[model samples]
Target: MVQNGQVFKILVVDDEMSMRELLEILLLKHGYDVRCAESGSSGIEAIRSDPPDLVITDIRMEPVNGIEVLKKCKAVSPRTIVIMISAYASTELAVEAMNEGAYDYFPKPFNNEELLSVISNALRNRGEEQSVSDSREGLLYFGCLIGESAPMLKVYETIQRVAKTGSNVVITGESGTGKELVARAIHRQSARRDRPLVIVNCGGVPENLVESELFGYRKGAFTGAASDRKGLVEAARGGTLFLDEIGELTPVLQVKLLRLVQDKTIKMVGGTEEIPVDVRIISATNRDLERMVMEKTFREDLYYRLNVLHIRVPPLRDRREDIPVLARYFLSKFTKDLGKEIHKVSSYAMDILCNYEFPGNVRELEHIIERGVAMESSRIILPDSLTLSMHRRKEQERTVPAVRSEIPIENFDLDKHMAEIERRMLQQALSQAGGVKLKAARLLGISFRSFRYRLLKHELATEDELKEE
Candidate 1:
């Protein structure tokens, strides 16, 4: 369609001449600059020579299928949105096409109005996405962190600024906010990138062993010290050492660590000589170290040493705009690991994710998407596929109205009351979902299998009517 003095170009690819002509006429009638490709190979060539604003390709083309064409379009021009159509559409093929970067998939004989609407919306969104990308070029940092939110951009700028120095850094954030990732980014961007970067969780190890873990021990220094052993600090010599949960370090261990940070040398346990070492210390903590210092819990002197350069990772809830990017990233990651074909997350599912206050932060989002990919049976992740936290579930359950009691407490028939309420909910959910059991199941936050079983239990539908979804 023409907008802002520029006409949107659309390429229609199909083996059937009639189908191609029909699409070309339809698209041209809508004012789109339309081109026809009789085969997927030609479609790929057209995309390479002059990438269109959008592509409409049939999935079953010979020599090169729509999935291949989609991949080539993404490779050649990532902004070129693709829509896949197939007369013989299957979930597997749809999933593969979506994972390969098709904007949407349609079964053959699709509604004309729906197809046109999708095309219009896709191009509009493509324009908006291009604008956003242009505004925030190089949004991804260190090939690991992803976001263009204000909080994340600030973090990226700080990483770039501090990564050049050898000063000790303290990364503060909630437990799952990716503090370790920020530490890794700092180390990767720092001068010691070529050297070893060792990570140790201060809270994971026992308090008794933390001292020896941070400073090497001599042979026969203790009963279990069978031979001379190098500590994690020594292992990180000439590079960087990431101490996660630095606030969890015991007072005595903190003193030992403070000396190392102060002197740049460590005296092995039961050894007289102090060995000099060069390393940048990056410590991360979810706790309020400042409060702990006031409370006389954490050592202030050590805190100052690690706080020379500070970075605070914003929680996922604070950067809701990043949820879509993070969710897609995790989807791509888990799909390959689980050998699942799922790629796209439904708009409804994404809405649920973006609205969620992820108490567990980015790590929780990763787990949610990973679980979604594993649980999803279709090409797109639906609301029913997402399994949020139990706390959130409980919170949702609280929002649901309590069942009204019609009988006196002494005469209450608990079982019958519960059954009646259950039946009523089932009917209401079914009605609201427009007789679609899957949607009804999602509405009630129940599984399709469970909904079907309940339907049988309550005689809501016959066996034939409630067959496998």
Candidate 2:
């Protein structure tokens, strides 16, 4: 008997014979119980009988297209993951697919990594329970941070081991990447689970109050110290203290923190006694402390002290495979919160969310889902509810996505249209400006920023030199 968690059953529906055969072979080789349909009609029938963990389909197909397949899957199983693939490159079409109900769209001539990324995300998003469910402390699944991608699985395993240690840990990732959640998970699994878990936002506090916040203040210590106050560290005594955004600590604050971590004691303001506090310190930050240390913005000593047990939260883009589950989690959250009985996301909408580069990470995704809940009148969240600025400046290229794309289309050119439009616009602006940024800005009726942006984009000037000229 096929059981859940032993092996996942995946479905691939495509009109093209080669595409269907190739995907089935790949999935089967990977130990998945894979099923395929050459047309949407057969695919729908298969799903109605035995629902699959995930579905991958081609946007352009015969008789029954991928769109139809996506609708049917959602109708039968709202949480079933769906990915749409197309040979034609079109953002307008992709946006439409997202609105329609597909989890993500893969442009043809894609990379193997890209296709795999989409598939992984789609499946991770499938969090629907086919039967009656149970919840603990408002969590759909306790101590479960779901992701099947290699990087996330590694993180999961690391968490299992690290939770046993009382040593300090540094959890790192981009904003909205769920650092706090990871910290809490660690705290929940730790020996001090019965003790209180204290959280202090290093970046959110004012500089003047930081010292007192970490170390208790005597009644007459400062202006606000009308009564003796116990700092977060003291409150977390015999438990755990979660310091988020640790890299934001100033040099002065870092010295105090270092003393606490190094000496195992904190001196209260205006108090002569050195109070030894027993607490597990788990620090999190999106910033690169190593780079910050080189820049002299962060303390290297403090970083090493907290880096003993490190848990890195991979960004949503890095593990697109997890997007589906995370999205569904957010959906269920909003559904209950909004008192709306929504069942599933449109296949197309799911496609856009799974494929897009969520620069803001999972937090950004949570916001999107919340917005979708408000906008969605019916049960399913529509892709149009997503407010990502596709035209915004490309995200910083410091780190490549952790997971690569899957299902690369052979001989397909990537981002050709966007490049073509950009080339024509730059050439026209230069012609109007006679190769001057200011002149081009005036001719294009754009700001100096726009003119400089075009010049820098077309390599007419270096990024740094663009402002100088």
Candidate that would win on TM-score: 1
Q: Which residue segments of model 2 deviate by more than 4 Å?
A: 1-144, 388-469
lDDT of 2 by residue, 1-469 (tens): 1334557788888888998888888777767788888888988899999998788888777788778888889889987877778887655666556666666667777566557655664454345432223232123323556555677768767877998888999999988887888888888988999999998888633454567768878887754356777787999999999998898787888998888899989988878888898888999998888899898888888888989988888887888877777788888888899898766665456767877777788777788888888876654555555654421323523232322344233322346445545656665676555455576677778888876776666654567544323
Q: Estimate each model's TM-score.
A: 0.60, 0.58
Question: CA shift at 269, candidate 1, in angstroms?
Answer: 2.1
Clashing pairs in 1: none
Per-residue lDDT of candidate 1, residues 1-469 (tens digit): 7766779999998999999999998989989999999998999999999999999999998888888889889999998888888898576787677667777778778778778977886777665775785456435689778878899989999999999988999999987888998999999999999999998778633454566667878888865566887888999999999998898898878888887899998888767788888889999998999999999999889989889999999888789989888888788789989998874786546766877777778887888888888888778886666884412531342222236655543324578679878887887787677556788899999999999898888866659544422
Scored by CA lDDT, what does every candidate get? 0.81, 0.74
